[model samples]
Target: MSRITALTPDQVPAESKSTLDAFTKNIGFTPNMMTAFAKSPIAFNAWATLLGSMSKALDVKTRDSIGLAVSEVNGCNYCLTVHSFTAEHMAKLPADEIILARKGHATEPKRDAAVQFAKKVIETRGNVGDADLKAVRDAGYTDANIMEIVALVAMYSLTNFFNNVFDHEKDFPAVTPAGAI
Candidate 1:
């Protein structure tokens, strides 16, 4: 059960009706987080726009990796489950790689750097050291890429915090974080 009740399908605001319906058509349901966002059209649109813009940034695999790392760091089961499903189905990442990503690692060097940087950003609260930036740059990421990395962290962190605070019921296949028993 959620701490704050999410509006039912029929109660979704007009501004997000079509989009939520599209999500329902594509995935068989509107995600709980989105239903909660529907309570605030501005919040819903901001998240949707940020998500849309990210489609042009890093590859899905990299974004999924960062999302997994942020979810783990924040201990958000909702995000952990959602990102796990997206990582495997949408990103087509290998099982082993998804496990690695939850631990803030990647088999690929460049992605590893980005994932590690994302973890650092969360651990340090955006106070990453000089060597942190240099390490990612040495891995062939430009300043623009770093900016996207930060954005991905911010984006995932936003959802992680929201879902954890709201206690949104899991709508996807549940994935326990690595250390959970």
Candidate 2:
């Protein structure tokens, strides 16, 4: 159960009610995290806006893949579960690919580099060595792509830490991590 109570649309402030409604209309339910964010509409709007902007930085598949990989590393069951569903359904990743992604790998070399880099950022706390930088670049990721990955890492980390800390209730089909990498 969520340590933080999830607010229904009727319960949140007016500014956040529409966003909660749209979430329900689009996804069929309000994610518990959003319900937590409903406590502060400013936080909700900031997260929503950042999510929109960060989403454009990478393809859906790559973004979802990174989410899975990072959640695995962080041991965030909520993220693992939600991201598994999103990766499979919205991103249209195959089951095998989803499993591979959680291990920081991909069928495509460029995407593999990206996931691996994301993993390194989390594992090393963003203190990657020069060789780490060279590997991603060698795979054709430009400086901009690298920065985007870092931004995505930060974004995913925020949600992962939030869910983990709050013990947020899982609203989607549950998906457990295979084990730590």
Q: Stretches of candidate 1 above 4 Å error? A: none
**Residue-by-residue lDDT tens digits, candidate 1, 1-181:** 8998879778889998776776677667678988887788878778878887987888999999999998998989888888998898889999889889989999999999999999999878899999998999999999999999998899898888988899888889977764562
- What clash count goes with each model? 0, 0
Local accuracy of candidate 2 as per-residue lDDT tens digits, 1-181:
7788776657889888777677677777778877887778887777777888998997999999999989888888888888899898899999889989999999989999999999999989999999999999999999999999999998988888988888886789966554843
RMSD of each: 1.5, 1.5
User: What local lDDT does model 1 show for residue 131?
Assistant: 97
| Count of backbone collisions within predicted model 1 | 0
